[model samples]
Target: MEYKNNGHIRVFLVGHAISPNRGSEPGNTWNWAWELSKYTNVDVFAYPQHRKEIEKFILEHPRNNLRFHWVTLDNFDPWHPEKGESGLRFHYILWLRKVYKIIKNLIDNMQEPIVVHQVSWSTVSTPPPILQGVPIVWGPVSGGQVAPASFRDFFGNAWPKEMVRSWRVSFYPLILGWGRRVSSLPLILAVNRETEALLRKAGAKRVEFFLDCGVPSGFGLPKPQEVARPPGPLRLLWAGRLDFIKALPLVLMALRRVRVPVELLVAGDGPLKLQWQSAVQRLGLSDKVRFLGRIPWDKMKEVFQEAHAFVFTSLRDGFGCVVLEAMSFGLPVITLDHQGVGTFLPADAAIKVPVRTPEETFQAISEGIERLALDEDLRLRMSREAWRFAQEERWDRRAERMLALYEEVLSHAHRRV
Candidate 1:
């Protein structure tokens, strides 16, 4: 397994959204970088806002193999996005330009060649440095997922903003001419089937469906149960940003149809918070559902342990890490049979229903909920399978897979030379 240069492979990783050790918050950029550093020397180019958090993590958990190069954006705070992501896209493009310049200079002076790894937002049409002659790896990119036509039709002619965003993805190949770049890429790691197809259509030489999401180490550590409380109703949990794409309204509709008495714990907040709460009252589900807005990341474990099942209603997601985390807590997931939710969960781990119409989606969800409520044995079996799947998806295993792909790309490049 010795590399061509006979030492640990050095990687110039370009990831703008990396926040090391921020588990409770979203984004898995830190986990991917940190885990890979165990197998390779990674010099990361990330935004400056993560500097304090990264510094704190480095101080507590030392790793000599990893180095952080903060790519600062002057006077502008893109991370906060308080202005509704108005200039976020432009800001990232400009930031990547700076990253390219830095890497281009470093690559010229380096003694040994290094691989350029673009972690997330692995668009085929990226900045120039990513397309250079050096062996390049782009992945876990999340662009091609589109919401079901049924979802869009039910919502209205206007189309939810998410659907509009998906439409924009179609222009990538035409505008960026990504196929030209894909023809030369050493490796392309797509997160979902839609992205895989898009990459292939873009003429990618080698494309692999690779998941870039995982929980932190010891994430599923079990705690003693407090089973002394008198059980009254079945508890269901749904946690994520309260956005249109999450399809929170559809979940509420499904809850209205459930035959058994059930209580739902909703964690997290977003722009649609007021609308969702109003919908609960409109549907007379005020008593059945409770909104615990923006629960702390550490406290999510307690919420998952209390629930018998996790119902995910996201119409389209690049990769749903929460679904996997719910599985780690031994909760059987009930989700639609599409996108990341369908891609990540095995048949045994979840009660996946088709997503064609609003009524159909909610009806299937209601039946799945009732099935879990009426059948204890079925729930137990599914929970066991979910936990098993989560164990198999640990971060270390994903890291090993990623490093192996890097080695393959580099060795192949060497052989060609």
Candidate 2:
């Protein structure tokens, strides 16, 4: 609880993206910097693309302890498609080199100790920072989850790409000599079980499991004493980028088997939008499903509030942040029992269907949905549990965990010296 001693501890947070206007990794970077500033002085190094949004937010709600530094390469865009994936990787490495020089210069002149925490672009494949004499905390990182082979048919034309990805995840560490680099880290935080297992297998000495996503402190506070069901047919919400990995078709197929009146609101937009829209008609679900493309982040709460339950069908994810957001709004979740959802979501708060044969999985999903639709008592119970679980994962609590990790790593570094 006592984060400040004689003065606040200084932290240099290295992340590629940090912005209040975005979600996922960019929002994650901003959240870590903002929340950690409550307990420490944070100097954030991020890409220049988010500069305007960050500045506007800071001007409106200034924090003396929080500062942002823009870091990028000259005449190079890391996200440019022409550069290709390899080019983007090279650009990230170059950007990080520039950040290292800045941090090294500051440390040479400063009297107080500093800690470097890389909070975003959370992937184990990326090279760790080379900051000697300064304590480093890597991750709550992910990228180890892979699509199941049993469900390869669901990926359609993307199956070949998925196969290549699965191969890379399994061997890239050894091929790139990440084993040596990872083993040297003082502390490495993993976001899911697969990532944690992979890190440990790669010879990491100290790896801790931690979720990469969290809700805001005031999110769903003053929990309602009673769960109120909206007067209508069972309303289910499925939200995510309409990507192949999301496997939206699983839910669509399952809906055909459900024996109850239910409506599914699909919220998001991506490459598969038109294709999935076609599938909805093909499956004869046009009457039961509505595609609400790309809802704004602030307005998503309205969508969640209207839904009776949340459905997560991500074949792979670091952790589905939207699942937590749905839970915060008192929606019981029905999700696949694998990856982050399988590892972190409380059994009491969700009905997790196992990853089995396609028909079996679809049937189970249908049964799960129908069960929740018919049993009001079960839905309310799970809703209360889901809300309670979300409250515990608030950003403030995650920040406390980070502060403690920083102290632990710093103490160990001092003992080694």
Which candidate comes out best when scored by TM-score?
2
Compute each candidate's TM-score over C-alphas: 0.88, 0.93
Overall local distance difference test of candidate 1: 0.77
Winning candidate number (lDDT): 2
Q: Report the lDDT tens digits of candidate 1 across residue range 78-193.
A: 54555566777778778877787888888888867688887745544462344565788887776678887767743444476756677777766665545676667778887788
For each candidate in turn, give its C-alpha RMSD to the true structure in angstroms.
Answer: 3.5, 2.4
Off by over 4 Å in 2: 1-8, 74-87
> Could you tell me the TM-score of candidate 2?
0.93
Count steric clashes of candidate 2.
Answer: 0
Q: How many residue pairs clash in each candidate?
A: 0, 0
User: What does the lDDT read for residue 119 in candidate 2?
Assistant: 76
